[model samples]
Target: MRDHLPPGLPPDPFADDPSDPSAALDSIEPAQPLDAAERLAVEEDLADLAVYEALLARRGVRGLVVVCDDCQQDHYHDWDMLRANLLQLLVEGTVRPHEPAVDPSPDAYVTWEYCRGYADAMMNVVEDD
Candidate 1:
């Protein structure tokens, strides 16, 4: 049966093994390149991240808290890590998996909406002054 397998398809190395490690892993399709609109959106996110980091970091804000779709849990990312992840996504078309911060303080991280609101409020205050 293995000999008759289709061309270009490698024979499974663990066909006879009952404990194949990959058996439980889902096959992931290759990442597709970002379209123009997607690229623009990512660029905008990067810009917003820069401003958010600059404005919030001074006030003891550690980073952003993002909810993970895969795990359905909150993940805390520091400013530098978030920046690097965004850059990697822009260049590689995929974000690399990373371990979340160890025992991060929930109060130190804010959501994107909070950052946006804070930035807007800061702008208004500046304008008022």
Candidate 2:
């Protein structure tokens, strides 16, 4: 039988990878749980989100609407719901097991333009005051 081996073959993909499972685990980055500062920052952001949510709610709005970067759709997620989604995304790399729709009133959900205008109006009022 004649040999059909190539003179020079490409390197194997798993050649560098550890063969022993223990060694492989050693190379893997242990899930360093979120640091205290990171957790606090995330919580702070959540709190700010609650403020935005409250503003919307105060105007008879049910929830804050956001455009999904992945879906590119205007998703109406409320304060806690959005927080939950964000947490899930952080943990699972996505909002898996997807949540049921908790649609906020469309009329209540204002655009960024409206919020900015409202802020400007408030600023004007404050300056006058």
Candidate 3:
């Protein structure tokens, strides 16, 4: 192969060879600064997380396991981890790296939608009573 790459350009491993099996890694940028309204919303979410932890942990709910759209796999975050992430966003305007639960059981984790629905149902029951 003739050297066509620019002076300082690193050659693409698969430039001419098409069977390298290397996946392109996506570059993740830092989160943008939160506006006043967004800041308020994050604060509210943080408060709601506290309530969720209090109510759900008693029911044996460990935490949430999210299937990241980017990674296309499940990531487990315990209640404390979720709280820390939200707090970091509010304070630093950026999320820290994923710190998933260690050897988390898929059975112990619930989706965010499930938690929302559960909370809604509980609220309705409380209102009815």
- List TM-scores for all candidates, in order: 0.77, 0.47, 0.70
Q: Rank the candidates by TM-score, best first.
A: 1, 3, 2
Q: Candidate 2 — what's its lDDT?
A: 0.56
Residue lDDT tens for model 3, 53-98 = 7778998888888888788989988887788678778876876454
Best by TM-score: 1
lDDT of 1 by residue, 1-129 (tens): 474332323355666688977656447775788889988999999999999999999999999999999889999988888887777677768874555689999999999999999999999999999
Better of 1 and 3 by lDDT: 1
Error of 3 at 82 (Å): 0.4
The superposed Cα distance between candidate 3 and the true structure at residue 66, in angstroms, equals 1.1
Compare candidates 1 and 2 on TM-score and give the better one.
1
Model 1 off-target regions past 4 Å?
1-29
Candidate 3 off by > 4 Å = 1-32
- Backbone clash pairs in model 2 (N, Cα, C under 3 Å; residues 3+ apart or in different chains), count: 0
Residue 13 CA error for candidate 1 (Å)? 26
RMSD of 2: 17.3
